[model samples]
Target: MSTANESATANPTVLHFSADNDIADIYRAHLPPGWSLDALSAAPDEAEKLRKVRRADALFLTETPLTRDHLAVAERLRLIQRQGVGYDTVDLDAVRARGIPLAICPHGTPTAVAEHAILLMLAAGRHIVRLHEDITVHGRWPKWDYRSRTLGLDGATIGIVGFGRIGQEVARRLLAFGSDVLVYRAPGRPPLERSWPRDRVRTCPTLNDLFAAVDIVTLHCPLTPENRGFVNRTLLERMKPEAILVNTARGALVNEDDLVAALRERCLAGAGLDTLTVEPPPADHPLFSLPNVVLTPHMAAGTRQAHIIKAQAMFENVRRVWNGEEPLHRVV
Candidate 1:
């Protein structure tokens, strides 16, 4: 990815910060005319990052948290556009206090993120990582044991925690795999934009009910104040001993300690976690040592295709903001 920071341009500058460095080239390649792109280089300090934001007319955010301090100095900032659907990292109160519109680009998220959730479900269910390590590192081929140890999605019951676009997409894919879906929508939420097929899709009145009924529980909900760490000890204990957990959503949506305990005690089969309470968790993080866990650096939606689509949408929103129009999916 190119670090072509055309900082000299007097045109409107859009500052972008993302953990995926490869996305820089794509964002620069799709740059709107006369708009400068400042992709924050390598992991800069908080002070330096805030300094760069001072000159930005719009902030294209991902991975980085925008706090009150950053917004205090963002005098030129007119808008903040999130690269994907979740805006949990941004300080909503601070952004609102500043009266800056915060937007999220969901154009390329549903399919990629949902597909990743499926990937995790499969990998965790089958203990793919453990088998691979056993063969490669230990020189043991547990072929016979694999049959009795692993599970498959074909006949499994899956509980989907949120029924948003990504959740619905996950249900669609799971149905194709011959799995049943149990959806749990939050109470008092607005009606779904679309309905699901009745043949394999049904609603679970409560989260505990869904956890108990399914062979696998995959979380697709956002991390809000009310739901943060909702997947705690009590919830984890509700699942069958053979059931696994898959989370492609925000890491803090789960309680890391509780999840670790469940996996350690063999009360839960395994977990496929793409997001964690902390990004770049310490080397000594408990989940790092668990054999039944499959973890990624929160890259479920980090595919090049998704990033390209996100970049285009972000620039289009930037254009709209400059034209004195609201962004496409403005959340605040």
Candidate 2:
């Protein structure tokens, strides 16, 4: 990936905060001929630099939270293309008030994230992390007491909070394990896609019902103001005592403080998380102290293949916006 700043062209300027230079290079290559690309640092101190160069025609945004103040400075900016699926960090209201279309590369994330969610589920169910630490770090051998704590996926009922692309993919894999799948979709939405055998999967009427009935519950829903902290004390309380929780979606979807309390009280068996409310959370984050929780940095969609696919979709949308055509995955 070339880092040298290319000469400006006659075409419109597309500004991006180069958090991942390799992905940035992919974006640059896919852009239409004559389009010019400019890079900015994703750090807060560099935001002023972004404001000074406010003539960008479009933005390829990463995880940096774009506030109303930031948008106010970019007077000519017309589109915001997110490289990944989650948009909770970007201020949608500000974008909509400006009439700038906001889009995401949803086509690129499902498979990798779904696979990660399953990995978390299996690891939590089997206590993989704790067992590895027990043997390698403490030099303890496997014993019958440790074996009694582990749970198997087979014959267990699994509940998926949101039946989107990733959730459906998870259901497909769980079925192969001989697990019963239950799904809950937001109100007024259509039924699960017909391709997934309807008889093999059942739909729950409400989140409460789903939580109470399943042996494991996984969240794949996007985080929004209305649904922020959707997995709270009340929902966690409703879950079966032996049930495990897995989250591969946005971290804010589960209230961290509440989750900590649940683990402390053993209200739930365990949790497997690939994201948290804050990235690189404080060194003393409570989740770190719990033996029953397995945490991974937010890398569910970080696979090489997913990156290529996401970059392609992101630039394709950018090309459409540049051509004054409707974007393929408009979210706002």
Candidate 3:
């Protein structure tokens, strides 16, 4: 979001974009010699993060919303390395305007998020969360009754809403479960890069067709302005009454109010969500009242192994920029 000092190669300072000390430590573990690091406090205020960003040559950002105001003060920033793949939290236009190289660590995200998507798919499909709550907290076992409600991945026709790295990973895992995979068609999307059973993996011509045909739908697309809240009532209505919905991509991809209405009306079977339109959702969020939904705190890709790998990439990019070279995986 800003420029490096004239003597960047001689010495450089880095800022940890978020307040997590552990994540800062992960990046610190890989810090180049003669380089210095500063970390924000846990639960830091906006002003606090801004002050730190202004003084650093590079930053390792996680969830903090890096906006134009922060960029304006980033007088010494030459590079920004997102800890994971998504960059929706950062103001990309502002970063570009400032001529700061923005890079992402895609290598850290795919497998962990893809695995969590399938976990939620199975958890929500079989009502595993409710089963645990009922038996563990209420001291009741409704084992036989559950036979009528349970959904399984085996022999199921599953639709994958996006076909990027995470989507392909999901398809691979789905195959191991004996499920057929249907990829949705988006303009200019590439063909499958690897082999899968031809009959089991192919594209669905339209969102409507995919929504109607699959036993379950899992979202793995990036959040874009054009597709924000695209999964509204009309799209949801096309899904069968027995079908389930799973979203691990971004919260704004689905219309939460519409989803709540659909769930309450029994128009859809259940939902497995790892994100909400608003993070740290208000205590009375409508989704909390539903028995047919399984929710996780947007941690689909929060693995330690991913962190170390990301830190390595982040510093390597920092070193590149410090040495007057381009950053790898540059997003803007």
CA lDDT of 229 in candidate 1? Answer: 93
lDDT of 2 by residue, 1-332 (tens): 11112222245678775553676777677666777787765553655555633877778777767878778777767678887777877877888887888888886689899889989998998999988998999999776656766878899999998988888888988999888999999999897677777777999999999999999999988887899999999999998888899999888999999999998898899999999998978999999999999999998888878887876776677666666678878889
Q: Tell me how many residue pairs clash in candidate 1.
A: 0
Off by over 4 Å in 3: 1-9
Poorest stretch of ten by lDDT in candidate 3:
1-10
Candidate 1: RMSD over Cα atoms? 4.3
User: How far off is model 3, as Cα RMSD?
Assistant: 1.9
lDDT of 1 by residue, 1-332 (tens): 10114224345788886543668789998998877888776868887888888988888888788889999889888889998888877888999898898999888899899999999998998888988999999999998877776879898999999988899889999999999988899998765445567768888889989988999999999888899999999999988998899999999999999999999998889999999998889999999999999999988998888888898889988777776677888899
Better of 2 and 3 by TM-score: 3
Error of 2 at 318 (Å): 1.3
Per-prediction TM-score: 0.92, 0.88, 0.94
Q: Tell me, by TM-score, which candidate is best.
A: 3
Superposition error at 253 for model 2 (Å): 2.3
Task: Evaluate residue 150 in candidate 1 and report its C-alpha lDDT on the 0 to 100 scale.
Answer: 85
